[model samples]
Target: MKYVNEAYDFVNHAWSKGKIKKLIAPLEGLAYCTTVKGFKEVGLGVQPEESNYFNFFYPKGRFHDSLYGDDFPAEDLVSDCICEAVKQYIEGANSEFQVPFVRILIDLMSNPRFTYLRDGETEKKYVHVIPDDDNAYLLALRGEFLAKFHFGNKSDADDEYRAEFTSEEIDEMRKMSDLAIDWSKVNYESA
Candidate 1:
């Protein structure tokens, strides 16, 4: 849960500096700003080094600084979208335990958001996030689905045998996760 602490630290620092409000402003539709703040409070010291802590919450981007800039590219403007989506989903999940580190790593790689820049123009940059519930939820669902699929047989550890699933299978799973999240209404009001 070290990375949880890191997430908390990141948010807490922002809060102390009066930036948490702006950081989560885009999440108003997905979850209340206060609720998102509360989520960060509980996440304090949870896991300080988990990669998803960054990918899910902070993401790989410069969008955070864009709030003060003028005219960000459409595709480079969704970091907040990704972070809020991830934080809200993690909060909604019924589990108190952390996703395995390996799974988290896989999620960082296999998630489609990591592969394509927002407009497919930039070469895999994480400048901005889409900041939409559908996009965020789809990203999370894709992470979870990939974990369930490629992450089987944890002990196999053989690098060569690791590459079994096809790009088609991965795409199919992503589609399914997106559909599930799209049709999902139970707990939709909470976040």
Candidate 2:
């Protein structure tokens, strides 16, 4: 499928309508993406000349430098939390592929408990990542969940961070692509 267009549509829909949702950009093939994020807006910028590439931007504001430093807030996401099932597929991905895949992540606050999940042993430890109002229970760490999910380690060590998931993890992740972006009514390309 046209995963590139799917990735673009996912972020575009999020900005246009402000309908917060969960989007998991796949890393199976060589993907071309700017970056990805969750919860917040990624500033504003003009579209790129290349139809294969897209970069969204947020307005200049308080968190401009940190969040909007790039055309869009570059989360450097690998998309789809790595389930324990398939942790080998992405083992050699970095050396083999350099495509930029992505996913949005936010540390869901735990005070209210309503927005957070605190039921199981595993669920209670990490910060709950609902991703949207739908309450899709994706767990995140108080620190960098992406690093933990991607590399199986939260440390910033280059080798550790670049570590890949098992083959089963990669297969499961491929099937787990979920970017609910609908451009049914809008002329997305022109807009």
Candidate 3:
């Protein structure tokens, strides 16, 4: 059975933290390939709007590779894994999306499954931190303890432990973020 509280925590952090923007803040106007969350091939654009908030854009389905080291796209044949970013894929996407790109990458990076299988141990219960589409962080369990950090895709089983955003929640966040963002901070440019 899926744990609701765990899922909620994961999503809360994933939604609230601006991981993508934090990571991308340093790489303005750079061209790079992406494979995070099934998004492929990306080039991020950042320019401040009249209100002083930065406007970020990328192809409809693209993410940064390095920022999503843990959950970057896998080779599985299954297709179509859209996240909240999809809303911004449209031309002139709202500035509210400016934060999630980085947060999503941060969440994806947090899900690591490096096992420390011992020679004399078996059936050990383990726990892990995982992030999901709904922008939540949750705990993942395994037969044994594993390191919290790694650089590879997780098993199919791990996919089941994710949370998702309801259309309502996405809209709520979008609206809330629009109010919470302090545009003045986004006015500065990188050297």
Per TM-score, what order, best first?
A: 1, 3, 2
Per-residue accuracy of model 2 over 93-185 as CA lDDT, tens digit each = 345653222221122111121121122212112111232322222211212122123212334443222222233433443355462222132
lDDT, candidate 1, 1-191, per-residue tens? 11222334334345432443443344334322212111111111122222332222222221112112222222233333444334543444457875543344345335543323232222211111223422222111123113332221324343221222233433464476433432223112111
When summed lDDT is taken over every stretch of 10 residues in candidate 2, the lowest stretch is 182-191
Q: Name the lDDT of candidate 1.
A: 0.30
TM-score of each: 0.17, 0.14, 0.16
Please write out the lDDT profile of model 3 over residues 85-154, one tens digit for every residue.
Answer: 2222222234554544445434433334211223323222211222222322222221122212121234
Candidate with more favorable, higher lDDT: 1 or 2:
1
* Best lDDT among the predictions, by candidate number: 1
RMSD of each: 20.8, 24.1, 24.6
Worst 10 residues of 1 by lDDT: 36-45
Each model's total of backbone clashes: 20, 16, 11
Model 3 residue 72 CA deviation in Å: 14
Top TM-score hit: 1
